[model samples]
Target: MQRIDRFTRRSLLKSLGVGAGLLPMLEVEYAQAQVPAPRCAFIFCWPNGMLSTSAATGWPAPSATAAGITFKAFQASLEPLRDDLLLLDGIDYRFLRDSRAPENTGHACNPGMLTGALFKAPGTGTSSIVAGGASIDQYIGSSLVNLGYRGLPSLNLGVFVKSTGRLSWRAAGDAVIPATDPYRVFDEIFKGVPASGGTGTPTPDPTVTRNRSMKKSILDTVRKDLTRFNLRVGTEDRKRIEAHLSSIRALELELDRQAMPPVVVGSKPVLPPGVNTAISENFESTTNMMIDIAVAAMAADVTRVVVLQLGDQGNANVILSTLGYKPAGQVGNTGNFNGHHAIAHRNAADKDKVDTWFQS
Candidate 1:
């Protein structure tokens, strides 16, 4: 495949002998190509089921020391990230509230919560239910992709708890399928060419190299056929072929960018302990890294949109550990709690612990 530094639809039509009268269609393609891509990203920071209480809710009684700074229980843990977040309160999930059907209250809630349709539990029977409705992210992703943003619509990432269940959900409310392994995510971000420069079509893992070759081969086949068929084809078909070939060339150029080497995952000299020890110390560090990756992807124009989930629904206990609380056994058996959802069931009297947990 020929490499492209600058591409224009007029040049393409001239090479293919598309008629001068068809210039209007080429003008539309040129306009789209000249426009810069728009970028949008969202991160879902699920610190597990919250210990919602008065201290976690209403305005805290004013402090004598600072006028504007009011401190609540959960609000304190968020102090560091306060400026970066928009905390919305009292919005209800009518789907979960109104439906009498059994909701997948744990990790199951992760998908359904956004999809707005009740997602069938992973292994429960053969059929799935409408957990809620199509989630906002899914709707946006589909719309963007359809609008000619061939760039990745979303990058689904995670620290642990692998599966499609971690990153995102489809428009139909099915799991969006995530890349739990950092390396795989990296590959998906950049799949063609080589780690170093000078384009001899650099080497890659078998699958990676093969996918690239296959794409090129198919495009080559189309280009050859189109060149011969253009004389016989109608104006509409010629225009369609011209537009498609342009898209294929643009995609190939994006693949070339992938040849750049990946940045190493972590900067530390030694690995930390626990679930994310292999990646980083705890949920906070892992999440921060995930954000960095997403930002880079956006900056590189790799994707127009991304959905980042902090952790799985019921099993996301890393935040508990990241916030500096004991994992097990303590006064009131507080630290003994394993999962976040399990801890959220506490009554109002346990406000202190609940607030402490969220503060983490």
Candidate 2:
């Protein structure tokens, strides 16, 4: 699974562009206070167990030294992020695996990864396995709420998660299915939030209503200014601004690929309907869009805790495209093998490709 967090930032700006993007644009805006950043956590999960670089795979084993974490060979794509990587070597979801979920260790251990409890594997099949307790993200969210943190208690988002991909749990037998559609997830998290970024319920005003009809995306008005600013700024600053603008484009995507208005000022954000999130090739944008929305939600204080699962432990639905390198029998995508999960169980050598794709 491509880490969506690594792919978005402009969403943070657009979602905040009016809501908090600029106090000057919106009549009401969040205080630009420099309070201590809220304590938050994000979980990015994938299938086929913890990926370990074994000698058989011909990849250098990951290790952490005094300097930082190291990933050599097949995992070299992760070199730039070595310092931030925490590679746990001996961890396993064995507590419940040894008890209730011993039969189908892969699928049964899914709930145990987050909840640390004996998962419920109803009946004889692993398909019905569910978490027996709340996941850590939920636990932390509750603690944050208790500490007076506002917005959503937590967020559960997913990319191409199928029925077997259950992860975050509110309680035993009560699985919190992740929101896969980026548009829906955005609405769920940012619906009630006024573009001002204020917490109070917004009352309708005729002036504000008229402005909403005339408003286009903030980017439409700022492109030339950004370009002029880009030419005056240093190389690094220019790159940062470009990335920011690129993210805004991603966040503003529509079915017709039109630019969406930044969260409407003085009112709820109204995104256009008809987002085609079901197309296979469109999954990349969908995944990245989800990241952009999730990040914006956190940055705008819509939510503090989020769980972004690409695919469940046993149901890795991501396709590892070889780009131009198509080997025999590897039709790719959903052709020969459906996705990573199938490749994992069918071909051992190809498993590294999945890891490599994600790391890249």
Candidate 3:
């Protein structure tokens, strides 16, 4: 597939609708290529740190602290987008230690990172961990002046995460649990999006499934404009655009694969065979699916704000062995050490391997 740059992809996204598979007709002008994609903010909460030990304070990426033009070997995974990345390392989370919230570790750090609010401790009545303020996602998502968009205010998805260490906070005392199930999230975001006469595509409105066909591929939906678009671009550019479209088509198939009609088992509806129902198993695929859905949601203008928390504090909710990384307790390879979180505390060397995968 042709690797499109962020700006180019977004610029093209304004003219494309690959997520919901349906868009309004275009206004019949080449100027649509110049339209900027909907602006979005994505926050990825990694399971834990790359630090040699749990006691480490800041990120070890050299480019983050020392002003540098290149990503170090430690950041090999980000090397592809090195030029596009802004390494603002060493930005202290001082708000975590303010009067309202004192800095803590283990189960407490995730809350204050984005919200700047202290974690409200459990008391006589309230028995859950909650941030005392709205995290940036909700803060900006709710702002009509800033990001008043047509779709959801924010879409939060996760991979194998559990109820604890929730990263997104909707408001004071409201810890927004991320949607860990990708299939459900995909359906909720891409289910209904119809065109109003097919001249130009309307933004994806999750609330509108009234009169639209839910089965047409996005390529089919935009076939008319796509042909027109092909006629205008240079031959080489057209080839590249075609490759990009192929990827979109693949994404469409993937959505369909997982969304197969649910089967009733013992009077209970269960996901189809293709869906990754057990997020903890085949986790690598599950994680990728969630991310793909996230990007598609933003690309389709389903939502302007998306948060993909890699995992919960267990970080153990998902088994790491699927990716070939064994956890700490797998003595002789027949045991069940599911998560790599324990490794970070026990042996930094083993944890470094997991860290490299995340950074890379």
Query: Taking the tens digit of each residue's C-alpha lDDT, what string does model 2 give over 1-360?
Result: 111122112233234221211111111122454455544455667667534544434334443362443345666665655544443334444555455665666555666566656554546566667766666666666666567654566778887777663767766655667888888566544554566543454334444434333443455566657877888999878976786565444223311111222222223344445656775444555666776776666556556677887765654455544332222343343333556666677657566655555544
Candidate order, TM-score descending: 3, 2, 1
Evaluate model 2: give its lDDT: 0.54
- TM-score for candidate 3, please give it: 0.60
Better of 1 and 2 by lDDT: 2
How does residue 1 of candidate 3 score in lDDT? 9
Candidate 3's error at 354, in angstroms? 0.9
Clashing pairs in 3: 24-200, 24-201, 25-198, 25-199, 25-200, 26-199, 77-360
The candidate, 1 or 3, that scores higher on lDDT is 3
Q: What C-alpha lDDT do the candidate models reach, one value each?
A: 0.47, 0.54, 0.53
- lDDT for predicted candidate 1 compared with the true structure: 0.47
Error of 2 at 230 (Å): 65
Winner by lDDT: 2
TM-score of each predicted structure versus truth? 0.52, 0.59, 0.60
lDDT of 3: 0.53
Clashes of each: 14, 3, 7
TM-score of 2: 0.59
- Weakest 10 consecutive residues, lDDT, candidate 1? 21-30
